[model samples]
Target: MATGRPYQLVVFGASGFTGQFVVEEVARVAAEDELRGSLQWAVAGRSREKLQAVLEKAAKKLGKSELKSEVNIILCDVSDPSSLADMAKQTALVLNCVGPYRFFGEPVVKACVENGTSCIDISGEPQFLEGMYLNYNDKAAEKGAYIIGSCGFDSIPADMGVLYTRSNLKGTLTAVESFLNIKSGSEGSCIHDGTWKSAVYGLADQDNLRKLRRQIGHKPLPVIGRKLKGRGAVFYSNELNQYSVPFMGSDVSVVKRTQRYLHTHLNESPIQYAAYTTVGGIGSVIKLMFAGLLFLMLVKFDFGRKLLIKYPEFFSGGHFTKEGPTEKQMEESSFEMTFFGEGYSTGQDPQQGKPNVKICTQVKGPEAGYVATPIAMVQAAVTLLKDKSSLPKQGGVYSPGAAFSETKLIDRLNKHGIEFSVISKPEA
Candidate 1:
């Protein structure tokens, strides 16, 4: 948050698969933007050699010869409190790329908060993200350290897409339904096993998340308008002409948290939201059903989980692999999330009349898991550094929307790669 730190930011898991991409993004952004070029940042991990290798690889790929020498490497490990503390003390912010986060995220968070260093992560695991807020929000606020989670492909597009729709509307926005479409080029797309493992464990532990929420015990947000209806498990979306299913990512929980924050803290009307992802036509829907059933059954047991993790490609039907997607596959893949919003026209009392306004907006970007994930993560970090005054006065745990809604995050993202656009003008 200040200039006195030895380094302004640190990518804490620089040797991991996604961490490498984050390193490249920081390097690329630094080279392209004059302000970002001035960033004093470092890469951190248990192995300095591996960190050096990541930097070297990034240097070759990004064609930035100075990256290897310019970027600092910090020796930090999740298991080593002193190392984490040391890493935390040296940086103003830590862009944590370590995940499945339920296992490795807390130590970095604890260290950052204790040191008054803000931290961010691309974690999509709902239990971990919410648990951090319940456990650390107070301490983080007391220490003036912001702990923000899900600053990545998982929910940023969905969460911020809803915000974009609300901001663009000329009336009081009431509710939104987002349909996510991921498109792949000839090479096709697949994600790493890390994400698959996280999903497996997260699905396995839903009860604990429910228990954690009960422990938090905040009052329910007021429903300002007609309740949004659910579209059963699998359904055909006539709008997009694709069969869709409920998204399994963190968007619903994250967006709802943001909406709650806005309604409670900012005195804004809360928006009811739902998220779904397209799965092609009826055949794909059937495949999805079979896969979903098997996944649900398998994730419920420890042995089944191990099998799922050990054989991700097989279990996920080639959607997840230990080796991850090829660069060509990553290059060819992109995603679009369309938000359909309904609300009352300006000056209309929602309690008195049926909604009369409608708007459609979209957030689209490159390959979701690796490419756009790093772009969003790095841009969020840049927003933190460059737009401090736009943030909440007191630092605390926050969702991307809660923390960045008032910031120029949408603009920054638009300028970078992930674009938020109004597809249809507000209509009454």
Candidate 2:
């Protein structure tokens, strides 16, 4: 399908904060591919001057002085529809790093869908993902162009990791609970400013989110089967030996969609899923609860959100800022997520209070926003390019698991420093 394209991939929004990291990672990968002559890609943004500067800086950061010389820079803007359409016509795939995706993402996707260019983005915004499906799924399917969202740290690890865990089990996967633990290895690592701005707006726009979900309608449940649902409540988990709270992001939403897809379309057994962020102790859990309450109360008003954005550090958790982690910090930083599964095998007894079987699976990677995101984002694009047969036949807005197959992505991530492992399994 991509046979005639001059460029295999295009990194749009390459001048932004996360975009810079993506450019550098692309450059690094490009260097390794010079011999094979297979890494044909370009960087694009609204301003040629800014794009040039970012490319130069990325070249210096990678210690490859000629990296910029080998890379291409194109000018494209979301506000300029013709330029976006031109961009879509030029590449087989577009990796969009532009975020707070509620505003700018749709038009670019529109351009790509019409032009039949495959698109992937590091968007964690649930509203954007759902709205795309509601508005553009049919168009993308008609054009044979796949559009995948939340491919980065937001939900890929959680979504794909769940499927990876399922592979190791023999019985039906009735339930899975994932717990997240992250630690910055050094001073330079941090949450990006884009994530901060997006979180603020995403929380504030609850009405639109509900409307979009309504537009998509719910996936039907299987007949005569155990139902799948997201876990409720914040509580202590005996499995991890820590207090946990519902993860305040799009992960649950993405994983839930994936499970629904598997059940309704693929006819796979349903899975009950839940995701959480761990607290060191009960005191931290109380603080988190109050913080969430304060956040909910603030998002109800425009002025309150502005105040929160103006002073992000007021809350106890580390604040998001424009500065990202240093290269050393990026490489050193890591994220670890442990998934716990408890359910009986197929045809096993179901009357007990809790199933006897227990399993633990883990997914780990480096520098969530800065490091792992770019890796996952780029890998998703490349996988879509090289492994077309592994994808769903029809193109639509899809979760990572639904769009890309598990073994292919897991192998890709493993080669790039992310690891998915079965930490423990029930005995024979």
lDDT of 1 by residue, 1-428 (tens): 43578998999999999999999999988876556558888999999899999999999998888988999999998999999999999999999999889999999999999999999999999999999999999999999998999999977898889999999999889999999999998978999999998999999999999999999998888887788999989998988999998999999999999999998899999999999999998888888889889989988888889889999999888999999999899989999999999988888997777788889999999999999999999999989988999999999999999999999889988988899989996544
**Shift in Å, residue 425, candidate 2:** 0.6
Model 2: residue 386 alpha-carbon error in angstroms: 1.0
Tens digits of per-residue lDDT for model 2, 140-176:
9889888899999988899998898888876666778
- Regions more than 4 Å wrong, model 1: none
Instruction: Identify the runs in model 2 with alpha carbons over 4 angstroms from their true place.
Output: 33-35, 186-189, 220-233, 315-317, 326-332, 349-354
How much does candidate 1 score in TM-score? 0.98
Give per-model TM-scores: 0.98, 0.93
CA lDDT, every prediction?
Answer: 0.92, 0.81
- Which candidate should be chosen as best, given TM-score against the real structure? 1
